[model samples]
Target: MTEGVEQLYFHRARGLTVTGSAATAIAARDGRVLAAAAEVGAGRLVVVGGGELSALPFLGRADNARFLLNTLSWLLTGQYAPAGSELAKAVTHERCFTVRSFHPEEDLAKVEGSHVVDARPYRSLLERIGGGILPDPYQEQAAFLLEAELRFDEMPRVIREAVTTFRHRSNDYEGLLVRGLPVDAELPGTPADPARRLDKSTWLSELWLAGFASALGFPLAYHQEKHGLLFQNVAPTPHNAANLSSESSAILLDFHTETAFHPHMPDFLMLHCLRSDHDGIAKTIMASVRMALPHVSLADRCELFLPQFRTGVDYSFGSANGVQGNGPTLPVLYGNPYDPYMTFDLDLMVGETPHAQQALEALRSAVNKVQRWVRLEPGDLLIVNNRRAVHARSEFSARFDGRDRWLQRVCLVSDPVPSAADRRGSGRVVETVFAV
Candidate 1:
């Protein structure tokens, strides 16, 4: 093992270095390609010489796997951004590995289904670590959790396979639910303060969900709210009834991406329910633009794919943090236009032209016609593919009697954060892109 190899292990690996001028991993040793890539005709190609580049990218030595995955991911997608590591320079080409390319479709999406895990095996596993999945220092906890064999080894095989499928095949639905995690039947009271808190015991269940999400993508955080807390408590607050924040009043939260206006939004979002609302009527709604697009006219779809709209920062960003200039005029849909990624905020985003406005409305109607709803219960985790679909919360009456709905939410980013350079410590929150 090299001095800075992080903890990646490869079995009987052979050394394969680029004999020609193609760029290579930084300081490869013991047959490891820390980095390397090149353009092959119209397709991109990457050769990782070191560690295991096979199967799961986030399981073994997730730290180094990120470097390996980012190298291949950028080449495949042609969306390259520096990882802020002085150790290696950026590669110039892209290629796709096992990670499946997304295929945009014109059909209405199917409702997402749940993959349940048995609680008995998980309970026995918890006894080994005193029932807590992560160690102290919350900001640094995710890395430790990722290293646990209990999480990686014991995750239900069916659930594991489904996650792999989503990672490879472009999904045509909103999100999937994972049920039967260990949660206390006797629940904690819903918190009311700005510092909404949960007990460590409760965190154990959510930690399992986080590990599941980490298997799909890198755990990511924002710098602005709660000083960029990795696990944010999504609950009702009296002051935020219409604020357009995740923690805003639980009055019908609109269907939108977790962070649409920001340049570095998370690729996936996992919301773990800590407590269910009293009436259970507070359903989480998701709308697949893919499913709705078939109903939309071609003209409206064309306008949406064009840069005819601009969006404002969600209130959670506050008024002071980032991108305060006139919001950039951006297309609602971009990327592989056939299987496009979308950015929309019904309240904060506005279409510049009447045609754009009509397109937005048409899109809303199309999505609404095929919306799917799920009311998450305790021990349930919902993973939304933020790239391919939009999610919103329905208006729920908040009794505020310590039993209102409570969910712990976290975001995942695939690429190494471009703002990693500005992170002061904790290595989680990136303050580089905004005016901090």
Candidate 2:
């Protein structure tokens, strides 16, 4: 295992060098020498093999897998074995929801018979638009009209009815399945088919956007400005294919609040499963600060409120120069005093004071306490209140088969925040990674 780890490390290091960074060897007290790696100005060193990797040898296929993982974790997390290293201090979080068979017959029938819009006309309009028949102005107008129709004064009541039964009380999250939309929904015909599969005009697509924004108290304008609906067919694309079969065993998606690095992060992030990996093992993991706060020490929680922390811009979108700076570090817990908002990313967040470090550790522990696991199946939608939760995905084997997992993602920004002009430059789509 160690030998395999060493080879993989060297291979990744070579790739990093090509991208303008290099990895060097650091001599340590024991025979184990650390590998010092840096890209641009960011630097990290890996301890090679330790606790988490100890079990790798018994698995037998690789010698260096553990070492490589430890090194990568150090780079991505800025700490080795963050959760595993401090088990006692690890906060206990929970997955308060479960996947039950969503009875399409019962659920769909209920929605169709409810006050929800029939959605047939909307689907027809979308199919026309997606087939490249609708012009840009017409498409935009259609979206506006659809939104207006769905926004009757009593619309909220209907939305409440749609999801009331599925609301999970243990956590501040809920979901519902509204299937049976016209299957031929597609995008408008434009000379430039940016999202080739279909334009954002499909009836089900618009319904999702409308329903999600309504649930979060965000207006359609806010949804269009601060968030975007993205659809990706991961089947044949080289990048996506690689993402499925990538050798990280686990893709180390460091824990992060969706868009926390931005001044206007989405209040909610919704992912609806359209397909599932054949083995059904791709688990989305989430840890809530709300659930973990009780486990933190009083002193640490207080210290964590200081404004001495900073998060890196590694995952943010901005100009080359703008991307170099760090995000403002206020307390991870702030606002309503009793029920504070949380901002965290273990890899990017940095504490400048000893108190901050202690507080961060305590917060980290609290976060680990309520670890929740969600496995998405077709027609399942996971709605995370980004302001209240941090999420990650457990790595799953992606064999590049047609059955690889696929999801449609949508984000929503709630009320009170100003519109796009108040937050971003013109001609951009809500702080997307490429918008800046």
Candidate 3:
């Protein structure tokens, strides 16, 4: 059972009987057993009084999802039982955790399924936000963001529903691509460098990104990256063409979880493409841990949960200027064992031991085996759950001209209170010092 989870909203609950000697009353309501767990002959059993506990509406009310996930982990491995109990003591003392890592080969076929939202019908409604005039995205003004949040409900039901689904079901897919979103009628030329700021005449694309991010979570920024600009420009630049950053085009951008080493890393990283590459082949590659885990060996999966890996900060965050220190040693995978979260970067993360290195390589191989490529076109917005997937880009030719591939990036966090100490007066920017 999850601690501090005293209130749970359920549609209808029934009474449960704990008849076995090994049974434990994990939960109760008005002295009536609402949930129970028992150790059978060679297996474990968990029973809930309500079938709607896993339903979406019920999950939104309290820590139902966490409770269910904890219950699942307990039943699968016999760990995370009621603290201070005999089962909990034995589980903790032994540390004999088991992972159900075996999965059918056909599961890969189902994991590649796409969740696309056709935004063609919502163009008119999107254009009305900000009184049809969008303010400068870099300006530290809260009015536009508040307006975007208020107007998010006015969007088409399909768009709103997609956002809600993406928010709730964090393990369903790695990314979501919304197509046919409104863009500027007369778009400005693509900036030639990351530092070059374009004078945008219209804010259709910006508004769409902000509105969608606001609806999902609080849009965030980093003082160390892009000077705390809420909206960052992702385009090929001559200086960064040969580097390992987002501005590079000549070199393949290695797979990475956005800000993987930082404590307050964004939960969702969104990219809205205003212009595509000249050849239209610069694919955005993504591989989810959910799909890749089944391909990994059980031993390697267990090793991935060990604290034998360290990650370095990205160069874009001033890593070259003595800020290139590696983060604290951490496990590559954590959370629910069956469906876990990951933090990985092919270039920045390194292993501390020989077996750990092998485990990391195994993870790389599994991710490559199930990687998917997406070619983003104009009016396409891609939202990725940073914790569940690692993303990269295929190498492409970049002229560094005004028409090169251009995309606007935004970061989001599910909740902002965790970074309250890093932010200034309800601002969206999180300080880098605190993040380190």
Winning model by TM-score: 3
User: How accurate locally is residue 399 in candidate 3, as Cα lDDT from 0 to 100?
Assistant: 81
TM-score, candidate 3, is: 0.73
lDDT of 1 by residue, 250-355 (tens): 5667778777777777888888888888888778777766676665654566578778887766667664322222355788878764567777766566788887
* Best model number under lDDT: 3
Give the per-residue lDDT of model 2 (tens digit) for 1-436.
Answer: 1222323222112211112235454322234443434443566543332232222111111233344444556678665444332331222121112223222231222333321223343544434433433223224644543453454223334434554432323243222333323332343332121123444443443344444545555532222321332332222233432231211223545567765666666666666655666677776667666566655654455555667777655331332322322666667777653456678876567778876777777677656655555676654556666776787666666555444565555566665345465435542144434343
The better-scoring model by lDDT among 1 and 2 is 1
Q: What are the TM-scores, per candidate, against the unseen true structure?
A: 0.67, 0.53, 0.73
lDDT of 2 at 147: 54
Q: Model 2: how far is 382 from its true place, Å? A: 1.7
What is the number of backbone collisions in each predicted candidate, taken in the order shown? 16, 27, 0
Query: Between which residue pairs do clashes occur in model 3?
Result: none
Top-down lDDT ranking = 3, 1, 2
lDDT by residue for model 3 over 1-436, one digit each (tens)?
5553555655578988788679888778888888888888899988889877665324433456457666877778776534423333233222323334323332222333345777777666656643465556656357777666767778888888887887888544578878877777788778865654577777777787888998778898998777787888899888888888888888888788998888899999999999999999898888888878766655566678888898888888766522433666789999875578999888778889887888888889878877776788899998999999999999999886689999999999998989889899888889857344
Candidate 1 Cα errors over 4 Å, as ranges: 1-134, 137-143, 148-150, 185-187, 194-197, 320-326, 432-436
Question: lDDT value for candidate 3?
Answer: 0.76
